[model samples]
Target: MSNETEPAPAAHGQPTLKAIADAVGVHVSTVSRALKRDPESPDASKSVRRIHRIAEQMGYRPNLMAAGLRTNRSYTIGVVMPRLTDVVIAQTCEAIEEAATAAGYQILLATPPDEVNAQLQSIQMLASRRIDGLIVSSIHLDRPDMVEEILRAGIPTIAVNRRADGKLHAVTTDDYHGGYLAGEHLVNLGHRRIGIVAGPRHASTAWDRTQGCIEAITSRGIEVDEELIVHTDFEVQGGISGAHRLLNLADPPTAIFAVNDTAAIGVAGAVRDRGLSIPRDISLVGYNDIPLVSQLPVPFTTISSPAAPMGSVALQQLLRGINEGEMSSLKLPVSLIVRASTTVPRQN
Candidate 1:
């Protein structure tokens, strides 16, 4: 017997569309069109959005895969990720799954673990399963050819949380602005000498952030010593080693900005291992204010992105591409959350 339970089986007591309808006092069919996002009924869209909120709260997904198979049109979409160990990715998927189920679609997930060959294999696997569309969360910044190959496969595809050279539609945050916000915060606190833990060379998230930080410093008529920058993987150990490199510089920075919250955790460790105190000895800033960040000893001062909404919108655009052959890129806004982790640098 296959341990794999079929999609949307209510046998496990998972909330169904009928559950949403009952909760919201609306009909199940009305909820259906609302999930599709372009409801013909004026009253239907409002009710659907409400039901969507309720379903998301209840952790409901219809598991409509069996129905798709029966109709000869698998209302299933494939999602490719680098990995889901990151809390940010996990939360974003929650939003995606809820939105997809509301729109009468099912999700098929795959992970490539950041290897190009594995990514292509996953894509092919999803294709073989006859997914109606694809939403890729990880894009190798260097590989244009891989994108072309996916496009050539004749599937409606969209990139989420990542981007390439405008060769494909991408739904992402205003990463540049996120970076600028961090830089501005640090600079406003009177830290001229700063270091950045940048991500991969090709990743727009890292590149834009690094660039935004530079722009912010330059705007204040300060020069960023290129020596303070270190490009590395978006991980905690990368933060530790990257911070080490910056702190060892002839003129170390009083402030550091990490690419993400996980890296910030490592950056904080590096500071302490070297006998430094956060904000007092050195200040820190990070991106993607995941929930766990706020609970830390010194809650991170970070840039916050709408991860779940981004996932929801990504699925909507992908389905649009599949049905209408129309596609466009989207950049959501971000905001900075000031917390205890950042403060004015001590007089040195």
Candidate 2:
């Protein structure tokens, strides 16, 4: 006897339309047409449903690879963000995922290590995956080639947070308005000399917030001291260093507005290190109203960017583009939350 003991019976291959047609006692061509009946064809719903049920029972999986090769569409969206480590970015990613799932599509997320080169690589990766669309939330907006390549790939692209000067579609908050609100609020509280902790210079949000603050202060006839404005990374240490620079001035500001809450918390710590009580020696306001800001020992007065809403809107726009080639720019609203950290400057 052969050691193999007669090879086990070959497993049955997946059922095809021909096998289903034979079981249903119909022609293979009839089964094929019935399975994919045109809308104009008469009363094909029953047959189509029957075919679908049979296919399901047979554990049929569509050859999506073949279809994608033919149509050059993967029915997937590429989402590029800085990193999920940032709470706001993480929340936005969650919202995007929810929206994409609701629309019967999948999202592929990529975090670019750096602003310039990461954008280029992200675009290439999305293109390679044959993604139907892309939503990019960038730290900087200087990548012309990235946008151009996305356009060349013939995929709809939406920029989030960072806006480009060109005609690309984007979804972002009213950053200037948010900044203006923060400025006006501080000025209303009688904070005459205000300092600003700004994010990186290349980021449009940072520029908008800075300009809005300047405009608000100038409109009130208050001179915005150039030395009071310090550009730093959007991190805790950045805020700490910025606070030091501002407070060390011969005439320190009565209040400070940090670009984001993380930096604002740092400013708060710096103020305390100097044996100063918050809102007594110096009032502080922050942006982004991130969760931890409110839960801190002293709640921060801050502007709230609708991160979740922005993410949802971006996904909705991308889906529209994928389904119907629709495109539009969306600017979401932001609000200011007054908390314990800000108050009228105490007269010495």
lDDT of 1 by residue, 85-184 (tens): 8887877787788888767778999977877789999999999988989988878778888898788878899998887769899999999999999999
Please, what are the lDDT tens digits per residue for candidate 2 over residues 1-348? 534222222137667777767655678997766654322223437667666556546654455456567666676889888857777778888999987765446789898764777777887887788788888887465556666766776778888876765567888899998889989999999999999998788787888888888788889999998999999978888999999999999999999999888889889989999898888889999999899989988899999999998888888877667756886888888998999999999897
Model 1 regions more than 4 Å off: 1-72
Instruction: State each model's C-alpha RMSD to the native.
Output: 7.6, 9.7
Give the number of the best model, judged by lDDT: 1
lDDT, candidate 1, equals: 0.84
Worst 10 contiguous positions by lDDT, candidate 2: 2-11
> Candidates' lDDT values, in order?
0.84, 0.80
TM-scores for all predictions: 0.83, 0.79
